[model samples]
Target: MASSTASLISLQSRPSMAVARISTAKPVQGRSFLSFGLRAIPSRRLRVSCAAKTETVNKVCEIVKKQLALAPDVAVTGESKFSALGADSLDTVEIVMGLEEEFDISVEEDSAQNIATVQDAADLIEKLVEQKQKA
Candidate 1:
């Protein structure tokens, strides 16, 4: 009787594990469908804004290269991180100051600290510039 009971318990646990696997698999399918739906909806809006963002990113790359005193041969892009370009904390502060002067927008200390990449700084600059225009 004891052996029979243990076998039954194991059988019961196996089905639960199978159910858990099925549940997890289902959510993965649901998420992919949700993401596809989201992408289709935003494509038009994203294309419109992407053009302006690309221009901002290009300008930011130029500023980052100049601020870091990089050689002309060195390439800077939106994806380039400040630390990877040899910018320490002080260098980063100076870069922020340069961006402020170039963009004619004041960056809050907290917002400045969040800028780890040229893209980040460009996005923040654009946001601030937009806010200033609205005001």
Candidate 2:
């Protein structure tokens, strides 16, 4: 009975390797321990009603035209492709940067790379704006 009790005590005294592995990962400086992989959503929210979505699309169209230096005669519709609008890769990058600045939202690299048309960008911007508002 004493030998069995001693073995149980020894087992309880040993630290868990799984716990050690978890504790080895240091938390990022200036962030709370519970905030791992959690991004802070800004308290300031943007209006994201349907009307606001329409406005966002209009604003995006204007920004695209301005960024690409498109002639006023060129009609930019939501369906208009950026390449068809004479925007190359560099131009697209600039346009995306402009959208980020205009909308006050950060676009992930993958999302930014996938935008191909005016509608795509408008839709993405609308979604991000809504997400920001929710956050």
Clashing residue pairs found in predicted model 2: none
Return the top candidate by TM-score: 1
lDDT against the true structure, per candidate, is 0.71, 0.74
| Most lDDT-accurate candidate | 2
Off by over 4 Å in 1: 1-52
Candidate 2 lDDT, 1-135, residue by residue in tens: 111111111123433211111112334574424211222232444644333366777888999999999899989987789999999999999999999999999899999998888878988888898899999
lDDT of 2 at 4: 14
Q: Candidate 2 local accuracy as lDDT?
A: 0.74
Residue 23 alpha-carbon offset, candidate 2, angstroms? 67
- 23-86, model 1: which lDDT tens digit per residue? 1122453452211111111112232122238888888888888888999999888778999999
Worst 10 residues of 1 by lDDT: 34-43
Error of 1 at 12 (Å): 27
